[model samples]
Target: MPRASRLAAQLQDEYQAEVSLEKGRGGVFDVWLNDQLVFSKHSVSRFPEDGEIQSAVNAHLAAN
Candidate 1:
């Protein structure tokens, strides 16, 4: 989960918001912001690329 932690730290720094991570087995990956589902690997059938999650976080922040 080191990569995830690093991403979260970067996101937290860029957005200046809290970031929480939940680790699980069997390919259960997801990202959320402001209680909204931003990305879901299970639903999308793929892992997000570098900067994708950050983009989602940015979009959410802009919307808010």
Candidate 2:
């Protein structure tokens, strides 16, 4: 939960993005941007490293 909060803060601060956190079961953790899936812990079987999700969001923002 703390990690999620930090990630939200980082995204909001860095990209001016509106972030929302949804409760999930079974260790689910994902990051989405603009309705696109940026990162998924379930798929990767691990959490994102520090700025991984941020980088993904940045790339998505730049592309679109």
Candidate 3:
């Protein structure tokens, strides 16, 4: 599966939150929650590790 599809599945299964993926040029992969950036591959120059984004989302959900 594609990265977005994989992450979307994980998020949907775990949190039941709505997820959408947008295609970007030049290898842009970003994850956003509630208009807030949770992960940005471009910024870090690397993809998130396993559970990295999930953890971020979890923290974001907990904080709100």
Candidate 4:
């Protein structure tokens, strides 16, 4: 997914957090923060909007 790559890049730049994308069954899109699932596209059936993914990750980071 193009957004996955873009999100990975954005996260690296914005948070300095290393992100790795792995293949899952079908075209499921899952966003994880520290091994915790943040966004599950398979269940939601939609890709996150611009800045949404980063914000979610940042929120989690800020809380920790």
Clashing residue pairs in all predictions, respectively, total: 0, 0, 0, 0
* Cα lDDT listed for each candidate: 0.85, 0.88, 0.90, 0.83
Model 4: per-residue Cα lDDT over 36-55, one tens digit each: 88888887788788887878
Sort all candidates by TM-score, best to worst.
Answer: 3, 2, 4, 1
Of 3 and 4, the candidate ranking higher by TM-score: 3
lDDT of 2 by residue, 1-64 (tens): 8888899999889888788999889888998877889899999999999889878987888999
Q: Candidate 3: misplaced stretches above 4 Å? A: none
Model 2 TM-score, all chains together: 0.92
- Residue 4 lDDT in candidate 2: 87
Ranking by lDDT: 3, 2, 1, 4
Q: Mark the regions of model 2 whose C-alpha exceeds 4 Å error after superposition.
A: none
Q: Candidate 2: what lDDT?
A: 0.88
Instruction: Write the number of the candidate with greater lDDT, choosing between 1 and 2.
Output: 2
Q: Estimate, for each residue in 1-64, the C-alpha lDDT of model 1 and write its tens digit.
A: 8777888899889878788888879987888887799988898899888999988877888999
Candidate 4 has an lDDT of: 0.83
